[model samples]
Target: MPDRITLTGLRVFGRHGVFEHEKRDGQEFVVDIVAWLDLAPAAASDDLTQTLHYGELAQLAADIVGGEPYDLIESVAGRIADEVLKDSRLSAVEVTVHKPSAPIPLNFADVAVTVHRGRA
Candidate 1:
């Protein structure tokens, strides 16, 4: 729980937005994930089976963002958090969904939603 594996700036294109134009045209979404788990086992055993594979994690996040259409980035974040937490090895997960091309009709660097979920 004290140690974590983090993946940042994983970008993918998705058609997720409120407006029709936004959904049809699609936009870029960036995701950052922090998975909290005991690293000692993996380190001592020197086996991938003892830890979560980041490549698989990234693919799962990409598939969720690219496959589904959600009106709120909150929902997207929630989904990512939920999926990542499926692994029993993970004690908790933090997911951030970034929306750079949001339809705000104003100047802004980026918009994002972050969610944290832990096992019950």
Candidate 2:
């Protein structure tokens, strides 16, 4: 697929970390997603059904982030990729999970894990 649908800066609260306090007190998580699909069909037909609806994707991402407690951001990204690929219309998905409030002693901008999953 040449065309893509991108959703960025989707934030949610989650209890996902290895530390005990992190699991007890949840922190904010940010997610960015890009889905690959053939946009020509939807563009030519001018039909919503022919393309991936990003609104639904956003909601699904939020749900996944806020639902489970994973020790690694890799797990979070993998789960999101799995959900995004559920739609056959999407040939591929790139997911980035960011943990700004991670349990790190250093002063860093952010911590994130990005993963790509697809059939093509």
Candidate 3:
């Protein structure tokens, strides 16, 4: 397994849902991202340049979650994965989008989608 960098519980308000009210009212969305890459270079040199900057990554995810509207969390996850993979240093990534305020008839804790992607 490769060294991992994780960012979790990034809360952003987005107007993303199938219902019109949901789009209008919006809700809080939580995002989690795990990026896999070699960490030896950064570890050895103690340099920020050799590794992925997680602050930037968090900002990127926040921007995606807060920018466009998507009917499904799956699309949101896919978009985050695609953007995170733009860094060649990362070999793979896992994105989880949690929709806590989904319009469901039953009592539930959360609704979420997770996507795993790798370099092709």
Note each model's CA RMSD in angstroms.
Answer: 0.8, 1.0, 0.7
For each candidate in turn, the TM-score is 0.97, 0.95, 0.97
lDDT (Cα) of model 3: 0.95
**Candidate 1 structure quality by residue, lDDT tens digits, 1-120:** 468999999999998989998788999999999999999999999999999999999999999999879988899999999989989989999999999989898999999999999988
Best by lDDT: 3
lDDT of 2 by residue, 67-102 (tens): 989989899999999988999888899999999988
lDDT tens per residue, model 3, 1-120: 899999999999998999999889999999999999999999999999999999999999999999899988899999999999999999999999999989999999999999999988
Against the reference, the lDDT scores of all candidates come to 0.93, 0.93, 0.95
Query: Candidate 1 versus the native: TM-score?
Result: 0.97
Note the residue pairs that clash in candidate 2: none
* Model 2: per-residue Cα lDDT at residue 42: 96
Is 2 or 3 the stronger prediction by TM-score?
3
Which residue runs does candidate 3 get wrong by more than 4 Å? none
Q: How far off is residue 114 in model 1, in Å?
A: 0.2
User: What number of clashing residue pairs does each candidate have, in the order they appear?
Assistant: 0, 0, 0
Question: What's the candidate order when arranged by decreasing TM-score?
Answer: 3, 1, 2
Give model 3's clash tally: 0
